[model samples]
Target chain A: MPVQLAIALTHLLSRKRQTLVSLTGIVLGVAFFLAVSSLMRGSEGDFIKRLIDNSPHITVSDEYRQAQRQPASERWPTGAVELRRVKPLTEVRGIRGHPRALAYIESLPGLRAAPVLVGSVVLTFAGRIEGVTLNGIVPDKMKQVSTIEDKMIEGSLEQLAANPNGIVIGAGLARKFGLAMGSVVNAASPGGEVRTLKVVGIFRTGNANYDDMQTFALLKRAQGLLDRPNRINRIVIQLSDPYAAREVASIIERGIGYKAVSWLEASEDLMSVLLVRNLIMYSVVSAILVVAAFGIYNTVSTIVMEKIHDIAILKSMGFHARDIRLIFLTEGVILGLIGSLFGLTLGLGLMALLARVELKPPGATELVFLPIYWGYEQYLLAAGFAMASAIGAAWLPARKAGRVQPVVILRGMG
Target chain B: MNPAGREGSPPMLTAERLGRVLPGEVPVTLVQDISLTIDRGEFVAIMGPSGSGKSSLLYLLGLLDTPTAGRILLDGRDTSGYGEDELATTRLRQLGFVFQFHFLLAEFSALDNVLLPMRRLGALDEGSAQRRAGALLAQLGLDGQAHKRPHQLSGGQRQRVAIARALANDPPIILADEPTGNLDSHAAANVRQILRDLTRELGKTVIAVTHDLTFASAADRQIGIVDGRIDPHWRA
Candidate 1:
């Protein structure tokens, strides 16, 4: 088969003009196949990875307990206390009166819980005031579920342990407000009292949107500032396996009698965009390959007519119609294989080139870095698609060639 | 009749009432009710003016067409009963043909061109087929020219390559339509002498279509056709 393929390619090569056109058609089909598929799939990968990082591992806040509901122990002597993560949708969970909620969750198969206090507040420094989400977390508990520790640019978790007034400011907010390590910023609670803290660390979490808005501090400091002493809005659960996000959320919802939210529940819009982008990319790229299929049909059919005399001579000389058909089909396969190899190289080259290219924001300063997003599985899938298209395009013409009557053609020529 | 009158009844190719209707706005019957028999190891010439069914008869005899009427017989078996596939098999194993233009695949070398039929039939692998093609070409006085393409060779060399192709399968009979029509007198005479010697030496039957009297005279038998029918009784 290799020898036959080599001979067929040699014959095609002898007619250089025709060979060039056919080869170009094949290469274009394959290259297009790889390019769009990679971009779309890469975008999906980037989005999913970001979504996983942006939210808690799993959250079971309130089904009906209201945004600021407090545990009975933490409630005022006669009045209900107000403390909740972001505003609760509704209801309380199994953690009521369970101070060992974190230990209890950790003991449950595959579940680990971290107590987090999410409080939105106003930050005032030098005369400028900006709204912020103050996420109060224990350092070790935060590391279990968040990529935060991995992203810190300066200052150690020990520094966080050392200073009771220690806090971390996001790089985006720090740049915006002229704040730095050791600088003082006054944080005001939603209820209007002010507390000042010295910045101990600054974290640059590559995600532009989230980095601009988040701040971190010790849970006790957040509790005092928010006037929710000994009360937390949510116990965010972490799991060993990332896929357990949905399953554990479901388990918490069913077993704890509260609404458990996965990342998808939180960022439905983002997930929707991911799905639509994949759909559009596949649709548009496949339409392009379909157009390329026509090129293949035209090329193979033209080559068939050009090689008619050769075909006739072979038929008259005792070549079976089937072997002749197989030759053309195999020719299509060879064209596809060659085109795929070339496309794989070209696609990889494009991806490599794109990776180094720095896409700066329009009208923005040089501080932001946007790394190119991609992975390698994209090339193999694209090659498979291109080969399938080539074979599909060549099928009809090959069948047409197989059915040509040698006697009719020979008689006509004579 | 007792066609060849040869031992073991050397297989004969017999065409009976064969006709071909050529396609156009309206059908044109190129040949009608043509019947003839040529035996193994005989050198026969069929001569006629243009449009006289000489080439048409060769095609029918070669099983390159389904006759409009009647039957073609090879080794006393009815060929009309054979399907296209069976007919092709019969052509590969028993029938050979040479055309006036010597339709060598222009891209292939002389030896490769000769080996084409056997290769198509898968009768031999590449190595054995090449050796057989080499032997046939050497026999046809095309030793070193075997490596040359048809365009790279002369008119004589190309015709010799076509002749080698006809004999590649060692078929029982050869059907040639104007075997010398495209050659110069020197090449035509050489081709004619080669056909005569082929019967005497290789003992291969050859049925040639030609109008040249000198070429016709070299054959063991001569038959003339005019207006699509053979006139064996007409002698010029």
Candidate 2:
């Protein structure tokens, strides 16, 4: 088999000039697969990670009864779902003696829940502070659901714990205030009372929303500032299977008075954007693949016609039509395999280069990084699609060439 | 002796009232009633001017074209009902063809050109195919030229490689369409000798089409075709 392939390859390689067009097409198809697919799937994975980080994956928050009647942007932010707000009973509800009520929510059949206090507050850091959203969080549980630990740029949990008046600033916020680790910050809590804290940590969420206009502190500290020691703004729950969120949320809601909302329901805008982006990428790139497939067909057919006389000679010499077809088909597969593999290498190179590119949203608004990412399945899908199109393109031409007769060819195209 | 039962005289190719009329608004009849039989070992030449249907007739005989009104028998099976695959099978295993020009693949070497037939047939393994190509090339005094492309070879050398290609399957019948038409006299003569040797020494039937009288005169039998009909006076 190897020797046969060698001979076949040698024959094809000899005719490089004639076959080059099709090979180039295949390479282009492969490049499309790698580039577009990487962006789509890469963005998909990133979107999911971001959604989980910045927003609650499952929320029991305040719901407004006449949400649909209200202007969409009123109760919910422009990008959030227009959900009715049903205020939760904020008094600390517990399982064990611990003041964590979410521990009870997490203990349900299959759930992991976190308690949080979120609100906008006026902040002062080195006399250069601004108004930012205060994300009051349970330090231990926040790390589980998000990459908080990995994102921290300055100070440690011990340092944060040591200062009873401690707060963690976003890296952007720290920069804005000209503050550093051990610096102090002051904020008007949710209830409009003043609160001050030492800067124990700094974080960069790889996203401007969290990094620019956000600040974090211990849940206990948040309770003190808000003048609601036993209350929380929201409780977040994560199920064993994310797809079962809506049903699980309902069950939890029936048992508790709070409105339970799944991430899909709450983050509809984000999901749609991510989905549309992927679809667009696939569609645009597929148009390129279609052209490449035609290129393969054109290349194979022309090569077959060019070799008609040779085909006749081979046919007369006891060569089967199937054998002729196989040779051409193999050539097609080879083109796809070579092109895709090369494209993958090229894609990775481009990815590495793009990774270093820090995009600033094309305007005065500044952003640190241009977002892109890909997981294993995305790469496989790209290569798979490329191979399918390439092989499919060659099939017809191979068959046509195989069935050519030695006599007609010898007669010289009559 | 009944001609049909002559001992040691098996017909390798037989055609009965073969005709082909392509479908169209008005069907065009390419060839009319034509009947002929070729024996196992004979060198026959077809002589005709342009549009005399010589090539078309050759195409039908070689299983490359369909007959509108007749049956073709290979060794004896009627070809009227044969499908595309069946025709391809007969062409692959039982016949060989050489054209006026040596249509050797420009991309392949002499050896690969000879082995091309075997590759298409997928019958002979690579080792045997190489061995057979090598022997045929050497027989035509082209062993040293096996590594060269058709373009690199002199006309005569390339024609010899083509002849080797024709003999690749050891088919019983060989077809030639102006085999010497494109070569110089020396190359043409060499091709003629090779065709003649295929019949005389290897016990194969050979048909050649040509306008070259010198080449036609050398054949054991000759048929002159005029306006798609064979002339009675020059039928043999």
* RMSD after CA superposition, every candidate: 5.9, 7.0
The 10 consecutive residues of candidate 2 chain A with the worst lDDT sum are A92-101
lDDT of 1 by residue, B1-236 (tens): 22254877635777788777777899877678778777767888888887887777777878877777768888778888888678778878887778778888777788878877777667688899889999998988888998898999989888889988988998878778788888999999988887787777777778988888899998888878777788877574
**Cα shift from native, residue B7, model 1 (Å):** 4.1
- Which candidate number would show the highest DockQ if scored against the true structure? 2
Per-residue CA lDDT of model 1 for A11-78, tens digit only, reads: 56677776566667667766766666765666566557766775676786745333443455365668
What docking grade does candidate 1 earn?
acceptable
* Model 2 per-residue lDDT tens digits across residues B1-236: 11332476557778777676667999866566778887778788888778777777777888878887878887777878988778777876888877667777787789988887677666788899999999999999996888998899998898888888888888888988888888899888888888888877888888888888888888887877776677767532
Q: List the residue pairs that clash in candidate 1.
A: A62-A90, A63-A90, A63-A91, A64-A90, A64-A91, A65-A90, A65-A91, A67-A88, A68-A83
Each model's TM-score? 0.87, 0.78
lDDT per residue as tens, model 2, A1-414: 542354447656866875677667767766666766766676576667666655666787755223334455665666666456756556543222223346556767776776777777888755565888876777767665556678788875445556667888888777778888888778886567897788899887666666878777887788778776756767767666776777887776666545778888877787888779878888888778778878777776777777776666556555567777877888778877887787677777776776677766522235645455657776677678778887898899888987786654555553
